[model samples]
Target: MDVTGLIPDFGNLAFTIVAFVVALSIIVFIHEYGHYIVGRWTGIKADVFSIGIGPVLLKRMDKHGTQWQIAAFPVGGYVKFRGDANAASAGVDEGAIAGLTPEERRATMPGAPVWARALTVAAGPVFNFVLSVIIFFGMAYYQGIATDPLTVKQMAPISGVENTLEPGDEILSIAGLPTPELAEFGAYVETLPDESPLDYTVLRDGAEVTVTTLHPYPAFVGSVTPQTAAADAGLERGDLILAVNGARTATFEDLRAFVGAGDGEPLTLTINRGGEEMDVELTPRRMDLPLPDGGFETRWLIGIGGGLIFEPATRAPSVGEAFTGGVEHVRYIITSSLSGLWHMITGAISSCNLRGPIGIAETSGAAASQGVPDFIWFIAVLSTAVGLLNLFPIPVLDGGHLVFHAYEAVVGRPPSDRAMRVLLAAGLAVVLAIMVLGITNDLFCP
Candidate 1:
């Protein structure tokens, strides 16, 4: 177990608490508001809209007689529809609507149409998804899509190369394909065999020229962290590792394998810097990195990041494209999450992949420390997870209600009150058990 896992720093702990609160509050508000607004639209009255649970901190009665309030806790929230037994809307309040007229009774949760109740319950998760999509679309719009008029700002140095590409050379085509953008060039590269020589059409000095270049996956340096062995040894951006300890490394993976095999020993490196060959020596440092399961593992590192084959170039996408990208992003997350869960169930992966509230709080703080954009992106990701989780076909979840609705539709009536009570209790137990398991993993996993 990592030392940080046993005891966290005070400053980090404070940030974690604050970030977790903010994230939870946003997600819960969006979820509860969905139920409240939809219920109102469906002609069912809502008695209260509350963020968090327990004692109310601030309350205001809307003109429509709905009590809006903020409560003491900030973990989760609920919306209490009128004439409901409790906030979960599990059953109806018979006494509350006993003497009301037909029109008045129809405006209460107990008297609303079956379809209206279903819609109201389903809205919570749907709204969470919508929030994620909107955030994703905003991120897409801000970053835009990468395009190409590919110009070489810098070239990775490779040893034994006689003809080096210049900085001003604009690559017009590769392998007989008219590469107008980086995306096309990347696709073309992916199709070709590694380390093979290819012909390229380049625009240099106001003229087009054809050149033959090897497609070797050199250890291209993308970044060097301060105070690291690589940085101290004078490695710079765009430098390429031609050989490690006199052995040629054709790919970044090869370099990693060699470094990781070392027992924190010094490494001999043959670097190619702008066609110039040089040698350097550096020792790998052991660093601990966080894991998804709320654990950490130490790894040998030179503090260098590699494998960026393109420059930063982006173009503004159309509104339609932005929305499509957002939807695709959410879909990707849901697909991957379900796939992971299935793999875990089959024992193909470790169960430690499950994270609890503590893990989420830790992640929230870490993301916040990175920057606002990073934190917002993290929030969007968490929102997507929340929405997807709520749709699991377990009792007490929105998906469970949906399943109940489907059953009622087929049988022409809801489940018996006793049956509903039993199912809800069972669901609550399963949910709590999962939470406990997650917390256990966070505390004891290695």
Candidate 2:
């Protein structure tokens, strides 16, 4: 068999692996560091703090006696506390504990108070969440929020349409309909006529002037989601959807309407990329989208986001506002994730939504290929998911350890060693089973 054709596929796979490793390593380091720092603060000594699993590739002993190391595997990491039998901290090292004095024993994880143990176990996920929040806050602050009065900052190029609106022009009305506040601009635009070359009344040079321009919301692509139908079809930002299956499309809504009406059938999209026309075919995927009111709606989607024809002027928001927005964004992701999981469980949505390592790696590569900002955003999102996953109350996870701590708190003792072993084994099985299911979906699902 000729092997030359496989070289490109191999190179792509390598890039995907590198991107996945980089993202996972950053998240794993932060999570493991959280456990290490909090355990130290609570007087629990760590024997080894490792990033990745398997044989150690590099190691260093700190003044505090913690062995900091990097291992061969780049998938996951852990902190082994004093008196821990293994990386998971499943049980005490009885011989090690017996050799230590009472004072030294107190510094061991098995010797620490239940409260301290619980706090250390919980810190990993909490730190992951904090990392996501910081990233979101920085991004929001850097990008700035859209300014009020809806002034045009810059005009976007549209194929076959002339734009007369200039930067610094404050839009007052479109097609004789008054423009609403910046928050309501989206809804306001939907109310406007779908026809192009609409009359725009704007305040320019301290004077109100009327000019003709394309519809504020045209069939323009502002963003394309990774691993979706559009991305699979090689769609990119700034590609205008001129027509759908030979039918002319005027606005983004027109494109959406056509896709919605297609009922998951293949679509022939006539695209205008930089004035060059081309046609591409793709089938719309059925997606369960989360709404603002904490519910979901199933819709046929191509996974491209649309925006107005002009970039809106923006103002730097106060730190408080930016932080609040960041927190809200994180909350939204968490709620949406939980809702999606629940829907999958209830058979309300496709189980294929549970992506495996392969899907995530592919997504990481796609996001990295887009640009640094998109890659960083993807890392933050993946970090949140990782943190949330570790918090599930399944054995062998941080949540399972927390649950055991809770039981100790109530029963005035930890579970029996045999019981602990049995529970840990069961938890590991559940985690492995989940991994298998995700991989199966990745391989077999459409």
Candidate 3:
């Protein structure tokens, strides 16, 4: 992804990585801070708190005895409680410290009130959601304050709906929710079902016109491919496929699955040719897709070019409108994330799309290619997802702790160690299983 005007001399890889680091640090801090402040307010002493896991790169101890450290891995962070299974392992000795004087004894994580512990854990995820909301609001307000043409001429090419939408197209609402930013317009399209109804209300020439069109996309497209049919087909950048075989595609995931099913046969394709649908034939060539475990398999892909396009809007949203729209965007994300999770658990959708860190990095890198605003939007959506997922009632998660707290409230004590250990073990298994599926999704499905 080259920035044509701004960074003609700079590489985007460096920028993407740096942007990822900055965004991660900010989000992680917000999440961890929720725990730190809540623990302190709840009369609990958090001895050490650090973001990320694995090896520590640097560290310092404050006068209050809290160790502030930066770890080599910056994906996420945690606060160590006074005690759990081991104290010495984490650089603190709970049993030995208890026998020392008040000044000499070390504060442990377990002695904190049960409610405090629960809140501390819960706060981390909560802050993630809060950060997403703030970022979303900023982007929304920025859009509202600036005006785009509100028509297809200046709209982005990847803008699934807005590009075709007219200047006077009244942006009544999206997915039953309202947003003022053109960026949010893409978000709404991303969430729509590939096969379901794609509905929208637009005001054309002062009349509310409903234009419900199918989403035209195949699958996730990216750089770094060694060799592929698309490369062989002479497909150039900025060429977006509006439809394939006459069926309008909305998402890449949609178009990809369709092409793969054709088994290397020539298929009719409708591309947005100079803002018009032009017919083309894509005969997918087979390529051996590498497997995660080292095996290789061939997959069919048509030689075609496609990508996202966002048109510059002539009209922007007002500050107040953008603020309101931002809030709604975050709320929509939170709700949609929870709903998607439910579907994942209930078998409504394929679990193959569930991703781990690899998926996140790939997504971040791809979004970064789209634009800075696109990357920021991706982070906000992911943050909402992280927050909602943490709320799942499973052991070792915030929601699980909350469940335990509720049980304590009723019974006046925590569960037995044997039971807690069993629960933790079960939770660990579930988490690992999810990881496996995530890796599978990344390699096999999408």
Q: Cα RMSD (Å) per model?
A: 7.4, 2.5, 10.6
After superposing candidate 1 on the true structure, give the runs of residues whose Cα lies further than 4 Å from its correct spot. Answer: 1-7, 151-181, 187-252, 255-310
TM for candidate 2 is 0.95
Per-candidate local distance difference test: 0.78, 0.89, 0.61
In model 2, state the lDDT of residue 191: 89
Which lDDT tens digits does candidate 2 get at residues 1-446? 33232223887878888999999999999999999999999999999999999999999999999999999999999999999999999998999899788899999999999999999999999999999999999898777889888899887766654358889999999999999998898888878998876999999999999989778888888888976899888888888888999999988889999999999999999999878999999999988888787667889999999888888899888999989987887888899999889988898888888988978888898888888989999998998998899999998999999999999999999999999989999999999999999877766665
- How do all the candidates rank in terms of lDDT, highest first? 2, 1, 3
Model 3, 115-152: lDDT tens digits are: 66677678878888888878887886555343432343
Report the candidate with higher TM-score, 1 versus 2. 2
Candidate 2: C-alpha lDDT: 0.89
Question: How many residue pairs in model 3 have overlapping backbones?
Answer: 43
Q: Give the runs in model 3 whose Cα sits over 4 Å from its true position.
A: 1-25, 83-108, 145-320
Sort order, TM-score high to low: 2, 1, 3
